[model samples]
Target: MDFFSRQESARRATARMLVYMVVTVLLLFAAVNLVLYGCLWLVGHHALSRSVWWWHQWTPQAILGTFLLVAGGSLLEWFRLRDGGRTVAEMMGAIPVDYATRDLAERQLLNITEEMAIASGLPVPSVHVMKQESGINAFVAGLIPEKTVLVVTRGALDHLNRDELQGVVAHEFSHILNGDTRLNMRLLAALSGILAIGQLGGFLMRSLTGGYDGRQTRNPVTIVWIFGLALWLVGWLGLLQGRLIKAAVSREREILADASGLQFTRNPEGLAGALWKIREQGSWLSGLHAEEISHLCFGESLNMQRWLATHPPIDERIEALYPGYLARMRQRQKNPRPAAPTAPTPPSWNPEGTLGFASTTGRFAAPDKPLFASPSPDEPIPFDGVFSSGGLVGRIGELRMEDLESATWLHRQLPVEVTRALQTGTGAKAVLYALIARFQPMEPARLRALLADRASFASWVEQVGGQMQSLDARFALPVVELCLPRLALSDAGEVTGLLAELNVLAMDNDHLSVFEFALLKRVEQHLRPKPPLMQRHALESRLQPVAVLLHSLLAFSSHDEAAIARHHHQLMSELCPSPPAIPDHGLPPLEALDKALHQLRSLNPDGKRRLLDLCARAVESDGILHIREYELLRVIAGLLDCPVPLLQGVIHE
Candidate 1:
């Protein structure tokens, strides 16, 4: 399935999750009422079957209370999870890998994760190791890609080689890109209420049993006992339902993830070898919460009934990756063939030909070539401000090996000092400041002013300023991506200062450029509280905001107003029965456009794809995506919770 299909599947799983919770709530309500009626009868009020007074008076209260209890419990658990992936990582007994970790295995793990992240247009997620678990397994968790964490058992590090480890890490990245982590988070929250109910029942049984005295209504001991029994039963059933849902929705995804990860590495053995190791060594975890998060693992975390298993059996998964793979492996063991070489970046790799996009996708050949060739950073990135009337159009969804190699290669071109700087929290903050200073040099006075007041930031900017001056424009985004993990390590006040300074530097200019807005937005995505999970919003209702955004993109990049209007006409013609009036007042300012982008965040996943298609066709008519347009489009896609790695393979400095 494509991105839209993945989104629809997530929505379907969410619907099932809600349904399960509703049924559990209703069952609990009935159980509570039944216990009440039985107690009243035992206390000599009225016959249980004939009781109308209590039922009429308390039924509404009982349902209301049950709903509140479930909601309150869910809210509490959500607050606990506010830190996103970090919170979940801690629960799994994972210790974060230091950015400057000395161990070779941990360092390799960090490098592989970083390459895959940049290659896929993802934030470099924090890496953690489950030191206590010896299982050959790993999984990703978070509310969004920025806050996402990658957790691997110590066994994975010990048993897997570089390629095997990369295969496993790529599989986890697939979850972040596919929107599975958010789904897992939602499911975790939904199940919390049932878990709380079960725990409460267990606690009550233990606490009140001694007061029973063998009397039916002895100080309400009998009533508490019945209520606890019913709750325990409901909790048991809720747990059963959770497992069934996990099996139904989660099992099929394992195959897709395996295929997607292999596509990235293009080494079937790399992934298959990982699976072979798992089959022989097993992926079962000894963590206390293993059973609860089995659905989120790279392999099944528990040895359970076949029907309730969270992942497909290891043999079946290996077979999917390479049919009749056991014999191939046995033969290989006898012959002992060498591990495969990493794939090279194809000379012809471009947005048009790679990732299933039409051969004439956007541009004729090398993307970002001009920017890379510029002798110095003083020359600003180029923008033709011209679009094809016919629009660049084609089907696109998958990643190619060139994407990973090219992204990694481009990142490696960065000066070694800059990369080293990114390994520390203070240095990462300085890198952000240095990027702003270099790219928006016109606003250096304001930047200096903002940093001068904050002593720590001031020193950081001074330290990195020299090396970053020669940094290629193409590496700006990559460096920003690398800075995230380190920034994540910064203290709260320091990060807040960094963000505030960014705003101070950017806002001094009356109207921000699309580039500046995107630059700020990218950093803020990780530094700020994560955006809420995607919720469905109809295109019809969101047209105005979408138009506001489209207008900014069309007007800013195009010198011809007529071309802008024509493209807007095409977008509206496709969207509405009768087109709405275009803004005669000209493109909305950046602040208004920023608001418009935020408002459109609620667009359904399918709607997001459609809107993006409309937007791209409107501006990308030349079959080539220039750097300016790519910057604009990439940021917009990021806000929509979509991946825009199309330009990742473009050769750059």
Candidate 2:
């Protein structure tokens, strides 16, 4: 399935699971109420008869009370997990991986994660290691990409080779990209609700039996005793249902993730080998909350019955990846051979700095230089290019294998200091400061005045600003994205201070460039604690506002006023048959544009898709994609939750 389909499927599964959970809760409610009524009949009326009239035992108050109790408990549990994936990680006692660690295994993990982040065009997720866990397992957790966390067990790091580790990390990335993380959170919430009743029951039973004290109860036939017994029975049943629900929801997802992982790495042997190691060794976790997040794990963390297993059997999973795995194992046993050592290969670079395909000769080679010619400003834009709104949606979380390889090459090509700076909080601040200072031409006196009191910060910016400015502008946004996960490690106060400094620098000249707008917008979106909620808006009612937003976008795309006007007319005509007049004012200021985009976010998916199509037209109207325009488009698409893939024939020059 495509990205949208996978997302839709996850939504459907969540809905179906919710329905099942509600039914289970109702059943439990009835069971609890019936038990209460029975106890009342026996204790209050002195009747032990099983065939007593059912109507006499039934009470509206009892039914309502039980229903409220169950529903309330479930909601409470759901609220407890509102912090999402980070909460789950903490529950497992996972520690954040230090990016500066010199450990080879840790460095390899960070490198693989960086490459994947670049390839997927998503922010690098926070990485954590389960120090006490000896399981060959890993998992990604987060309701959304910005807050996501990827966790690996120490055993996974120790047992898996680089390729095998890539396969494992890729599997977890599939979860993050496929919208499975949100679904997993829902599952965790629902199960906790169901188990809450059992926990209450256990507490009540313990109180009645004097289990909490050093004495035993004298009377076992009291109403409290009978109710406690009923609750105990109900609680255990809930536990059973919780496991069954997890098994039903998670097993199929595991298979799909395995397939996606293979698609990402194009290395079935690596994944298949990991599975082999799991079968021969083990993937079991000894953590406290292992059972709670078993379904979120890459491999089954608990040994469960077949019907209750969160993952398919290890053997079955291996066989699915390699159809004749059992036969291969027998052959290997009979004629074991040492694996050959492979030589490392360098990345291929083209003379024009464009990426080119390298031959599979285990050695890098330079490509022949091609004649370079710049397109004229008057060149006609290709209106007939293959552009699919649906195809764009499908590319949201999907990455080609070639992109991954390119990302790997790109990571190696980056300056070592720049890479190091992105890995820590202080360095991340320096990078951002340098990027902002060099984003546009700023008067030296004005900049110095703006930083008059902050000597240390100003010095750092001056030190790095030259290097940052000399680098290609196209890489600025990507580098900033790489720094976000680490920057997130800063305390709330530190982030607030950094954001304040950023805003000051952005507004120093009283005008925000397209690059500055895009940079600040993307950074704020990640750092801000509360994200804007998506709401539905009527396209017909909001057409003028959207047009004004599009006008601003077009104005930034080209310097030619006539060209901008033509592009605006073209897009308006396409969106509305009877085109509305362009706003009387010139290009809206950055603040106005920000407000317009915020309002446009409430447009329904179809409306957003149409807006993006108009955006593509505007960007292409100039017959060339400028770096600033490209960055703006990306920021807009990201805000709409409709990511566009890198366009063809668009160089970042």
Q: What digit string (tens of lDDT, one per residue) describes model 1 on residues 43-120?
A: 766455565634744577667766776787778878888788899889999999987665656766777788787767
Full-model lDDT, candidate 1 = 0.71
Q: Best candidate per lDDT, number?
A: 2
TM-score of 1: 0.81
lDDT of 2 at 563: 77
Clashing pairs in 1: 362-623, 362-624, 363-623, 363-624, 391-621
Count residue pairs with overlapping backbones in model 2: 0
lDDT tens per residue, model 2, 535-632: 57766657777778777778776778787777788778866788777676455456667877777877765676667767766766655566677787
Full-model lDDT, candidate 2:
0.73
Candidate 1 segments whose C-alpha is farther than 4 A from its true place: 23-72, 211-234, 330-397, 442-450, 453-463, 490-493, 507-513, 533-536, 576-589, 622-624, 646-653
Clashes of each: 5, 0
